[model samples]
Target: MKDFGKDLDEELSSLDAPPLGDLVGEAVRQGRRVRRRRAVGAVVGSALAVAGTALLLGGPLRPHSGGAGPSAVVAADVPSPSPVVRQPVTGAALLAAVAGVVPDGLRTGGYAAQTDGVNGAQVTGAQVYLTGPAGTGMIRVFVTSGESEASCFTTESCRRDDRGQQVVVDHMKGNCVQDVVVTSRHHDGTVVQVNVATCLAWTEAEGNKPTAPALTEQQAIALAGDPALSVWMTAEEGLRAKAAYPDLPRIL
Candidate 1:
């Protein structure tokens, strides 16, 4: 689980807001898991409830036994879900870049819509955790799920669609699912939303050295296992992430 925004969080945490620190720590942990399993599933536990896992930004660590995975959302016993990761995208480009490494003959799945919501607002980037066969490349792609113009302040409809959208179907066969959604308060007293999922988070010490483009295995494990991680929100970072992605809601 290589966090792309740890340093900024560290600088922010120097002030106060212990909760934000916890969230950050969890993020760090998730980053580690991604590295260890390459953002895929290495070990399968029991089924995890969609509402059970959320996001975190903390020290590197391992994923707690988050159960297996959610029960398959059979498409009314129909043919199956549609093929996601359509062409014309870099993420698609990247998947094509690594598809040669995936030797399962076929593997596909993606969000319900093209956009997704976090906390109470819509966001572009989504956290996707996948599980692959041993020796098969582990995959994780945070892409646009879909836009949500409907269901704003409530979680009923949004929650169902949210959970369903987070799941990816590989080769028409599903093996991955989203975990949970949690709301956090930033150091400045702002509320932010973060999501989490099951993955073999790599730690800093064992995965890679903390640097500009990577994190180690030890660090990843610490972050995943520890809930004290997932700290708070970075108004600056959020603003930047949102600004960079204009389509995404600024609700964070």
Candidate 2:
């Protein structure tokens, strides 16, 4: 009886136990499911990292309104630029001024002029040779930067005008033909001297006539009083004027 009971117990236990192959198959399926989950997690993590990197590389995004179009960006206030300034007058312009002030019938023979800084800053000079029925003569205009101490040869010939400008009317003592010089010194330290003479130092063929000059002493004073002839001139204008009279003297 004991032998029979032992065999029965062994059979019952064997029947309750599961198959080894089925257990192995179940374990393999569980391992495959775990691996799949890990791979999916890794893919999701890599995609998130790439998106974060893109956001970091690009600049900060600007805020947008409800409208589809981009909003206008208003700039800060800034100061406006200064206005452009024009340069001073030219030598050719000065020559034209001289021509305008002289007598109506007198014709221009020759001229020599200079702008302020190109030739020299100390003296700005312009000389126009005029010829008319009286005789061929010259009109010289000189403007110095500073005050001139030049006085008349005789006190009787020097007098002050209403504008407080010293006026000098004198004749060339050494020359056979009397040449007149009208000098006016302004209160602003500008010295304008107008020389009207029958003789022109440049040309010997048409000068030294016994007749009066092309312009009279009164006309010379008026020409000297003209504001056209001044020491103020632009460098660029002076350069052009200098080229106008290439063969003539620069600061005569």
Candidate 3:
């Protein structure tokens, strides 16, 4: 026991031991290697995660098959809406339509007033005068309701048009006079009458003798067959006609 501690110390000193700086440097290098390996593993794992996320999506990150960048898609052209076309109404519009379809060589003079009754029923209609090489005459259009129950004609011959509308022609015969009456009953129970009356005498003093009407039977029939004339039978247009011609009577 007298020299045991000293002997132990001497023995420990005699044994070879690593320096503090060397141990510290070796530990630092080992630590750097371990950190590098960990960093590499983390970068690899992050890359795999990014690839998996791209596949989970619709693969928008995937390269194009053409090897070029994605192409822009163009949208189709849309057609513009067409303009609306409105039908003609009102007394002036109706008169215009009649004037347009009138036979050639006949010029519209001006609107006039003509009185006529159908089936003993008094109905007021619009009137227009026509002047042409043939002669000067008048065209009258009458719109009346309850025409379905009325007789086709009292003294004149009647026929059906291609549209199945009842057509009546009245030819008033007199020396130097041509008076033609063309009447029709539409399917909607509206009656239209076009009367063309002409006299050779330009003045009343010349004589009351009649002359050829400015229009023919076929032309008169065509004017009466125009669909624009039917607008007066409608309630909306009837009111307008009444407003324009306050004396116009209601046939319905």
State which candidate has the highest lDDT: 2
lDDT of 3 by residue, 105-140 (tens): 777764633233323433334556678786666555
TM-score of 3: 0.46
lDDT of each: 0.26, 0.47, 0.44
Instruction: Identify the runs in model 1 with alpha carbons over 4 angstroms from their true place.
Output: 1-175, 178-220, 223-231, 248-252
Model 1: which ten-residue window has the lowest total lDDT?
166-175
lDDT of 2 at 92: 62
State TM-scores per candidate: 0.19, 0.51, 0.46
Model 3, stretches more than 4 Å misplaced?
Answer: 1-94, 114-122, 148-155, 174-178, 200-211, 231-252
Which has the greatest TM-score? 2
Clashing pairs in 2: none
Error of 2 at 135 (Å): 3.5
Better of 1 and 3 by TM-score: 3
- Please, what are the lDDT tens digits per residue for candidate 2 over residues 1-252? 001223433433333211112211111122111112121111111110000111113333354435544354322222334333323345565665577677688888567665443222333456687888866776666554434333343433777666656676655444322256566666645556665655554223543334357687778877776666654544555566556655655421
Model 1 Cα lDDT, one tens digit per residue, 216-238 = 22222222222221212233433
How do these models rank on lDDT, best leading? Answer: 2, 3, 1
Predicted candidate 3, C-alpha RMSD: 51.2
Error of 3 at 164 (Å): 1.8
What local lDDT does model 3 show for residue 135?
65
